[model samples]
Target: MTNDENQELKRDKEILSHIQHRYDEEERRFQSVDTKISSMIGVLAVIFTIQASLFINILSNSKPDICLIVLFIFSLALYLISIYYFIKSHYFKKFSATPKPSFLMEEGAKKESEHTIVKDMIALYSDCINDNEKLIENKTNIAKKGFSFLIYGGCLSFIFLLCFLLELFV
Candidate 1:
C-alpha cells in the first residue's frame, strides 16, 4: 500500500478500536448505575426497619395520632414503589467477548474472507453501542425518579417524627 493508503488503514483501525472501548465503557457505566439503585434500595430497607421500631414505640403511649399512622403508611408505600423502579431498570444485557468459531465454511477452493467478516462485526458492534447508550439513558432517568422518591419519603418520615414528639409533650 502507498503511504496515504497505509495512513488511512491505520486511522480506520484506530476508530474501530475506539468504538469497541466505548462500548465496554458504556456497559460498565450501566452496571454502576444499576448497582447504585440497588444500594439505595438497601438503605431504604434499613431506614424502614428503624421507622417501624419508632412507630411501635409511639403506639405504646396513650394513643398514636391517626395522622402519624397515615403518613407512615404513605411513606412505606412510596419506598416500595421506588424499589420497584430500581429493580425494573436492571433489564439490560451485559456485553462479553464473542466466542471463537469452532469451524468455518469453505468455498469451492477457499474459506470465508476475513475482511468481510470483520466489517460485518464492526457494524454490529457499532449498533450495539448505540443501543447500550439508549439503555443507559433510560436507566439514568429511572434512577433519578428513585432519588426523588427517597427524598420525599425522608421528608414524610421527618414530619412523622416531629408530630410524634409534639404529641408526647401535649
Candidate 2:
C-alpha cells in the first residue's frame, strides 16, 4: 500500500479508538448514577424503619397527640413517594451498546474496505452514546426529585420527634 494510504488507515483506527472510549465512558457514567441511586435507597430504608417505629410508639399511647399523628402521616407519605421515584430510577433500563458480534462478523465477511467498516462502527458508537446519555439524564432528573422529597420528609420527621420529646419531658 502507498504511504498515504497507510496514514489514512491509521487515522481511521485512531478515530474508532476514540469513539469506543467515549462509549465506555458513558457506560461508566450510567453505572455511577446507579450506584448513587442505590445509596439513596439504602438511606431511605433506614429512615423508613426509624419513622415507622416511632410512629407506632406514638399510636400505641393512650393519649396520642392529633398533631403528631398528622405529622407522621405526612412524613410517611412523602417517604413512600420518594421511594417510588428512587426505585423507578433504579430500574434496569436497556442501554444501547455496540453492534452484535454476529453482525460485525457478517460485515467482515462482506469484503468491505476497512475504512468503510470503521466509519460504520463509529456511527453506531455515536448513536449508542447519545441514547445512553439521554437515559442517564432522565435517571438523574428523577433522582433529584426523589432527593427533594426525602429532604422534605426528613424535616417533617424532625418536627414530629421534637414534639414527641416535648410531650415526654413536660
C-alpha lDDT values of all predictions: 0.72, 0.88
Instruction: Identify the leading candidate in terms of TM-score.
Output: 2
For residues 1-170, write the lDDT of model 2, one tens digit per residue: 78998898889889989989999899899989999999999999988998799689777974768998898899999998899899999994867778879869988899998878887888888888999999999999999889999999999989988998888888
Compared with the true structure, what per-residue lDDT tens digits does model 1 show for residues 1-170? 67986676666677778877887787688778878877887887787788777777766765887898898888877777777776676554444432124322322125445444445556766887777777788887887887788788888888888888898887
Model 2 earns a TM-score of 0.90
Residue 128, candidate 2: alpha-carbon lDDT: 82
* Model 1 steric clash pairs: none
